[model samples]
Structures are given as structure tokens and as C-alpha cells.
Target: MSAFLDQLQQYIERHALFKSNDQLLLAVSGGLDSVVMAQGLQLLGYKFGIAHCNFNLRGEESKADEKFVRQLALSFQVPFFLKQFETSQLAQESKVSIQMAARDLRYAWLEEIRFQHGYAFVAAAHHQNDLVETVLLNLVRGTGLAGFHGILPKQGNVVRPLLFATREQAEDFAKDYILRWREDTSNASNKYARNLVRNKVIPILKTLNPSLENTMKSTAEKVALAEKVLARQVEEAKSKWVTEGQGFVKIDIQGLQSITNALYFLHAILQEFGFSWSVSKKVMESGSGISGKIFYSSTHRLLKDRENWIIDYREVAKFVPVSILPTTQTVRLLFGKVLNLKLLEGGLELVTILKSKSSVLLDYDKLVFPLTLRSWQEGDTFIPFGMEGEKKISDFLIDAKYSLFEKERIVVLQSGQEIVAIIGCRSGQRYSVGQATKRILVAELVFIG
Candidate 1:
């Protein structure tokens, strides 16, 4: 008992995770690790509340676990919060693995509750055994050094109090304290990859060397330190290679060539532009080709132009112009660009239609009569969605990061003098749609050099 207490005290003192007045949100699963963690914090007299997630995967067994945890919290006279997860549905919707989905939902909910309830930190029960397992998994899966670094003791507002303890130590403490905990049957089955490692690989490894956990933990610590140095170098390389543009980042091909790890540097820059790591690699590789190349990520696309790679936000660029019903004189904005009005089949793309799928295509049929094209003026306003009233077009333009010259050059496609779509800005929120409308204008931007 003294050994357990001594180790727990040493872990807390080494990490400096909490102060006397700190409020921690302890993640309790009614498992051995979590039970030991809660007891350790209690013994230390740290102020904390217990939180549990019931994923509803094991039917009665899941509820029983929750009940046990709730009663345990009551025994300690601590505040208990419980949440149910739609694990399968969430996994499908998020397009992530079940394990990843559960993790995201768990931490997101925990942080949300923490912020709302004034908790200083969130505590989890990940320990040395888990870290070793994670490192092994990452190595087997061909992951980078960061992935091999495994679980961190402190990450932002989340703290892992059991990081220094081995699974054997935790089990011993639980048994000595007579701590009752629920065991998930899935943990024993080899159906899951983690279970295969925990049950088969780790046991065989333990037989070979009982101190395998300690050795793996030491290796993970060394890898984490090396990764930190590599990360700092990558950050410095990124600053040299990337240039900030309006709503975009430009990568200098020359500067990128100077980077020590070009692939890593590209990954860092592309993430800043909201591109995926794979797409970023493709963009970087495409830099060698003579022709321009494009690769799409979830929210954006990387365009490798001659000497620069432009990461364009595809979502933001999906806007089409509305057709003008009655052709009006072209309005020449500050730039050489002119907004010409012409009759078409449908209302403008931005003004009339919004779609979840498809690019910025306009319906050219439903344009109203007397369309006017003009630049946005000061005090100009339009109705934007989810607002009580109209908003100034200039303010909207500023929010959208339009330069002075660009704002002056913005051509508004107006239907009968009522703004249908502020060309490339937003359709006047009020002039957009009605259920009765049959035809719509097809608006297209024509860039004249």
C-alpha cells in the first residue's frame, strides 16, 4: 500500500498536473485503471468530478458498468456526469473507424462539458502499458515518429495521471483495495486489432521479458524527444517555404527545395491550407511536372501552378453567376473587368440555388427583367441568412477579405435593380428565392484580360 501511494505521489509531483484549487474532470469507466486513477486523486485530495460514457454496445452489461461508476462517484460524494454514445451511427457518419469515432466523441464531449462547467482540466487513465501497446501498434502499422511517441502525460487541458504506472501495478492496487470493476468481453476476443495485441502479442512478449513495458516506455520517451526536435526543424522550414496570401498560402518551389525534409515540410504547409497529408504529397510531387496539376482533399484542392502551389478552398470557390433577363450596358469596375448583362434560362447560381453536390453551376432560365451590373458602394447592404436584418455589403466584403481595389471592382448582378447576387460575393439574401419561381438565371464570371 505504501509503495502504491509512494508511486502515485511521485507521478503527480513529477508531472505537476494539478494545484490544490484545480478542478479536474476525471474520466471514469468503472474499469480497473480508471478506478485506480480516481482513488489516487482522492487520496491526494484533489478537487474533481467523475464523468462516464456509456456507448450502449454491450446492452445490459454497459448499463451495469454505468450504474457501478455512478455508485462509486456517490461513495466518494463527487459530482457524476454520464453520456450515452451512438457509436455505430457516429462512426458511419464521420467516415472514421469505430475506435476513432468513439475517441473523437468522447474527448469532444468531455471538453465541451469541461468548458461549460468550469473545469480546469480533464484527466484520463492511460498508463505505461497502454503507451507500450500504442508504440507497438504504430510501429507495426508503419506510422511516423510522432505516432510511435504514443500517449502523452499532459496534452493541453487533458492529463494522464497513471502514465508512470504499469498494468501489473494497477491490477495489484485494485485487488489490494478491493476495487470492483467491470470487464468488457470484447477485450478478450481477437476480433479487434488491439485485443489481438493485448492478448496474444503482449503476453508472448511478457513471457520473453517481464520488463518489456518498462523498456518500451523508455524507447517511447526517447522517440518523443527526438520528434520534438524534428518538429521544431519542420516549423522553421515551413516559415521559409510558405507565404501568406489573402485567404490562401503560397508555397515557393525554390524555398521548398531548400527544406531538409521536403515531404514533411509540404505536409505541414498543406495542413495550414486545410489540405490532407496525402493530397499535399501529391501536390509536392506534381511540382516537377510541366503542366499544372490539381489534387482535391476534403475541403480544398491543391493547384500546382508554374512556380507556386495554390491551395484553393473548393467549398468557397463553388459560386456561379445569375443570368440577366434584360441585357443592360456593361459596368466597368476599377479593374479592367466589366460586368455585362445578358438574358439566360435561370436565376444566378449564388442568388437562387444552393446545392450540397455539384460545382458552381447556374440555372439560366429564371432571371427577372431589367438586370443591372454595378460595383459595390459604401453603405451598401444586403440580407444575409440567419441574421435579423440586412447587412452592409462593404462590411461583408471586408469580412470576406476583399481589398479596396477588389471591393471597388466587385460587379453586382442585379435583377430589376434589386441585387440578385453581388458578383462573386453573395446573392442579396432577400432577392434569392420563392417556392413559386419556375425559371432561374445562369450567372457566369467572365474574366477579360
Candidate 2:
């Protein structure tokens, strides 16, 4: 066995990545690093299968890579799994870069295949150079301390067995073993950030430090250790300052302000909610200035309120005004709520029905048929229940102390041109069930799991 294979075996054992009896799904791209990894695993007598993803980004080159990986798998006499993806189209659909789309697609498929085929781990061929590049890229893109750790040896089911080796070491091993591997021409191009770092930036840095990979690898390890400590601290802080509810998270402004480097702590607290550092910085700076300033991430929105920062899922569904016909009994609303419409005899019990916010009683005779149930709009006016004067919906929500998210989700039941009930909150005076009412329309908002 070659010394490189021995080193690879030692790295695997040291990391306790997998056992000899354990099955591994190797992610092979027919590149030098992956090819060397396959050879190393084969020589070490581990049970593994080759899995290749043809992203279809390079057309003929991508096909050639798949062909090469398939033949290699046959030569090794192991099962080969291949998947093709329309990466460019997927990138557009997902609204992410081609690289990110490809990464997401491959990893997801790898995990799926692993579970289907009963593999213990999915092996990736990321070497020390990749780790160094990732750290530098994170720095360039302005990441937090977690990014400084670079790629982990084991992340979930994905294991990097070649993380102890550099790119040069992999190339040398392939050459020494007379191994054949396909070279991706794209790697030579400096268009992608990773390629630019690998082909141009790292080389420049290596002039000053010959052992740049090892140096960066050591730095990454130290940073990873520090990250663990910071993580514990952040968790403790979260326990004290953060409170999570059904669909929202609240961060106490005073608790956050008391921390040293409050902005950093805020960023740490908000990162999991998909808030960017810049957005967190803005939230930190907005202290005690105004309430109702909103910040958004792709998945969540943060609201600066009186004493807390409220984080909730950003509602993406566009509200089309739902038409409520007189015959209709049940209608589905946004946010897992169902509106059940029922006509009841008016004289039974009006006081009990008026108290609950989730259900409201309105005079069935007063409302026009085909009422519009839609999100509240600005300039919407209604005479609130027990009031004689018209009040703007906006003013009512403000007086009721609705949060930014609550205001966005508030729906109003409109009879002809006038709003009869602010759903789940208040019924308009025009539609109130009174002594003169014969039929009562009960609109109760039921929450579905």
C-alpha cells in the first residue's frame, strides 16, 4: 500500500468517520481529489459505493465526468449511483447562484441516496485546500466566527475523509498510483469566487507563507474551538434574553443592550433566523428610537417594537380577496386558520358570543350577500362595535396595539363597500346583533394544526 493510502486510513480512523463494516456513499466527480479518495478507500478495504452528480452545467464535459466515474466504479466493483440535474434552470427557479444550487442539489440527492441504500455516511472529497479557500471566501463575504472554522470534518451525514490532505497531496497520490482522472476546465477559470481564490489569491499568499494550507488549517481549528465557546455563551444569553412563541421569537431589547458588544450578540442571536449581520446591526442601532421599523430576511422578518425585537416568518402568500357567498359555510384563510360561517337564532345568547375574539356575532340581515373577506387596506373605515363614528382600520389596529406582523395578517369582512367585521378582533356597529336582529351570523376563526 502507498504511504498516502496509509495516511488516509489513519485520518479516517482518527476522526472515527466510519467503521470497516459500515457502508459509505462516496461523492465522486472524477476530479483528482475525489479519484484519489476513492483509491484510498478501496485500498483500505472499506465498503463504499460511488455516487456521481452530473449538474449538466458543462454539457459534454459533464457527461464525460459521469462516464469516467461510472467506469471507475465498475473497475472497483462497487455500486454506482448517478443523478443528472438541470442546474442552470434550477438556479434560476431557486433564485440562487449556479454554485449554490448545484451544492444544494448534490448534497440533498446524496443524503437521499444514502438513506435509500442504507449507507452509514456520505463521503465528500474536500481537502485541506478547500478548507483554506472556504475560510478565505467567508472572510471575503463577511461572515461571523462560525464561518472562520471553514468546512467541518463531519457535518451531519457528510464526512470529509481527505480533509487532512492538501490538493497537492491528492494530485501527487494520483500521479504516484498512475491513476487517471478527468480535469474540470472550469477550475482553471477565475470567474467563480472559489476558483479565483484557489488559482490566484492563495498562490499570492503562499509566496509569503509556504505552508499556507497547514497554517490556515491550524487557524481554522483554533477558530472552531473558539466558536464552540462562543456558541455556549450565545445559548446561555438566548435562554435569558430570547423567548420563542408559536410563530414568533422575541428578543428583549434591555437584555440585549446589557451585553458587551451588543451588536455582535444580536447578530449571533438572529443568525439562525436568517437575519444578516447588517440587518442585526441596524436593529441594534435603532434602540429606543421608534417602534414598528421592520427588517426582513428571505425567510423571516424582524420588527423593532417598544421593548422587544419580534422575529416571525415573512408571509409570502399574496392575499386574494376571498368572496363569501351567503351559501358558503366554511372558508380557509391564510396562516392555518379556517373561518366557519353559521347562522344562529338571535335571541338565545348575545353577551357570551360578543366576548370572544376568535368568534364574532353579526346581524345576518344587515350584511349584503357575497361579502368580501380580505386583508385590511389603508384608509379602510368602519364604525367599531358600540361606536357611532367611523374609525379607520389603521387607527383601530394602532389603538388595539397590533404588532407589525399582526397588522399584516389582519383580515376584514366587507359588506358591499363597508367593512362589517375586522375578523377575529371586532365587529362593526353596523352589523352588531341587537334586539332587532332575527338571525345572527357567527364567524368563528378556527386554527388548524
Candidate 3:
């Protein structure tokens, strides 16, 4: 048995990555680490095939890489699958960086091939040194426990057999086997952030401790264990403070704030929803940010409304202010909400103006036709009827104790340039219907469709 094979067996068993009978799709980029992995897998006699993705950024080097991997596949006596991609075009189309485009394309294509060819797992060549670089990059970017864990040995159908092995060890293994591999010139360039970390930052840190990779790997394993314990605790907290629906989650802030580790609980919860640390901290420190205060993740939006933190999938709604006319009794609105209008012959109690936040009664003479129903704007000033002075709409919401999120969704019914009502919230005191008023215009906001 080969020395590399011994380590491979131990690594596989230690992680329970795969059994000997499982067919693996080895993603070989013709790079040293991948080539070494392919050779090691072959040496171990695992039923596997080679898959290569040629992301055409390096011109001839890209073509040569494909050729090298194809030949290596022949040498290994395994099935070969080759895919070519216009990486630059993909990056532009996907609106991601070139490296990110290549990564997404290759992985997606590899998985496609794996299922198509009936391979049990996709064996990737990410190793210990790469793991260290990932960990350092995450730390630099300020990640939580998940980032500290770096790369896992087994993730879904993907298995990294070389994760426990170092680059030097892979190079040594290749030398021992006299394996030929193609080198990617892009890896040497510090143009990419990961390359900068790998080339300049990791090298500098290596001087402080040559065993940095092993040390980080050890720490990562320890952190992974701690993360599980933390996750268990967070899940327990979730049961207490959080509730999930079909497309959204609601966190009871009142319950969350009572927890001693509220910050940690918030971090864990927000992280699960993809909110960054900066955004999460801001939300927590906001002292219950106004209703309609929205923080976005790539996939989700977290909103703060009074005592609850609501996380829901983001719907890209284009809010084009709807025109409300005297003839228009009802109109559909965004977010499954509706706005309604009514006209009454007689005036109601003037006290109702202060009582009902949902309906506002304004003297019909004070309001103009063709009202603009729209969300709030900056510098919008409104006089809550009977107030001595005009107040900034923002300050009024704060005074009313509306969350940032609620404030965002607050609709303003404008008569000409003046705010007649913060629809469903407060009507301008200036436009209040008095006892002498003969006609009343009721601007009613219907919350849902």
C-alpha cells in the first residue's frame, strides 16, 4: 500500500466521506493538487472517472489543461468528460466576477455530469493549504463560526479526499508517482483577492509559524465542534423566539432581548438568513429599528417591525406611485395590499382623528382630487392634526414608535404637494374635519388584497 493511499483511507474513514464501492467523479483541472488527487485515487483503486472544465481565460493554457487531463484520464484507464465554457461571457451574463463565474459554472457542470454519468460523489482537490487560505480570508472579512470551519471534508455529494493533506504533501506524492500536471498561471497572480491572500498574506504568516495550515486545520475541527454546540443552543433559542412560515421567519424580539446571549442569538439567526455581521450588529443595536427598516441579503430581507424581526424572501417590487382620483373608489397596491377611498355627507367625531390610525377623516374642501398615494420620502413634513408645529414625517413616525420597517411601508396620501394623511397611520391635523365641515373625505388604507 502507498503512503498516500494509507492517508487517503484514514481520511475517508475518519470523515465517512465514501465507501470503496462508491463511484466518484474526480474534477481534475490539470493542476498539481487535482492531478495528485487523481493519481492517489487511482492508486487506491477507487471506482472513479475524470471530469475537466476548460474555462477559456488563459487562451492556449486552457486548451492545454484540457488535453493534459484527457490524457491523464486515458493513463488512469477511466472515463473522461470534458466541458468548455466561455468564462468571461459567463461572468458578464451572471454579473459575478470571472473567478466566481468559473467556480459556479464548473461545479454546476460537474454535478450535472456526475448525475448524468451515475457517479456517487464529486471528488474535488481542495486541500489543507487551500483550507488555511480560506480560513484566513474569512477571518479578514470577519466571519462567524461557519467561516472558521472553512472547508468541510464532505458537503452534499462533493467529497474533498485531499482536505486533510497539504499542498507540499500533494507535490511530494506527485513526485513519488512521477505524475505530470499542468500549472495555472492565474494562481501566481495577486490580482484576485484569494491569490493575494495565498501569495502574499499566507507567506508572511508562514514565517511566524510554518505549521500554520495544520494549526488552522486543528482549530477548524475544534471550531466545527463548538459550532455544532452553538447551533444546538441557537436552535433551542429559535424554538423559543423564532417562528417559521412558508416563505418567511418571525423572531420575537421581546423574547430574544430577554436571552443573556442576545447578541450571539441574533448573529446566529441573521447568519442563517445570510445577513452580514455589520448589518446584523446595526439591526440589533438600533434599539428596535423603525418599522419598514429593511436589511437585505442576497436571498432574503430582514425587517424590523416593533417587537418582531421578520425575515422573508425578497420580492423585487417596483413602487410606482399610484394616482387616486375622485372617480377611483378602490385601487390595488403593492405587497398584496390595497388602498380605498370613501366620501361621507356628514362629519364624524373630531376625536376619531386621534383614535383611528387606519382611517383618516379630512374636510373634503381641504383635500384636492387626484391624490398621490406613495411611500414616505425624506424631508417629508406633516402636522399631526392639532399639533402646534409641523413635524418631519420621519420624526412623527419615531414619536408614534413605528419601527424603521413600518416607516418604510407607511403610505402618504398627498393632496397636491401637502401630506393629507400618512395612510393607515396619521392624517395631517391641518386637514382634520371639524364640526362645521359639511363633507368628509375618508382615505382608508386596506392592508391586504
| Best lDDT among the predictions, by candidate number | 2
Q: Estimate, for each residue in 1-449, the C-alpha lDDT of model 3 and write its tens digit.
A: 87877998899999999998999999999999999888787777798999999889999999899888899899888999999999999899889999889999999999999999899999999999989989988899877888999999989999999988999988888888788888888898999999999989998998999999999999999999998998899999999989864235788988998989688889888887788878888878764655567788888888777778888666646567888887888867665667777777777664455346567778888778788988789999988877868999989888887655455567788889998888777778878877777788876766652
Scored against the true structure, residue 415 in model 2 reaches a CA lDDT of 91
Clash counts for the predictions, in order: 19, 0, 15
Give the alpha-carbon lDDT of every model: 0.73, 0.89, 0.84
- Each prediction's TM-score against the native? 0.71, 0.84, 0.70
lDDT of 1 by residue, 1-449 (tens): 45887888787778787777899999998988999999878887888999999988789999999999999999999999999998988999989888888889899999988999999999999999899888888879866677778998888999998988998899988888888888888788898778889888999998998899888888888988998897798778767777754345567886796666688878766765567666767777787886456677777766676567766566542224434434443444332344443333443333434432111122333355655556556776666533547777878876875543244346566555555566654555455444444444434444454
Candidate 2 to truth, TM: 0.84
List where candidate 2 sits over 4 angstroms from the true fold.
Answer: 1-10, 13-16, 55-64, 84-105, 171-178, 185-192, 236-249, 298-301, 312-316, 325-327, 343-350, 363-370, 416-418, 433-440
lDDT (Cα, tens digit) per residue for candidate 2, span 61-162: 999999999999999999999999999999999899999999999999999999999999999999999998999999998887778989988888999999
Candidate 1, superposed: residue stretches over 4 Å from native:
271-281, 320-449
Q: Tell me which residue pairs clash in candidate 2.
A: none
Q: Candidate 1 at 379: error in angstroms?
A: 33
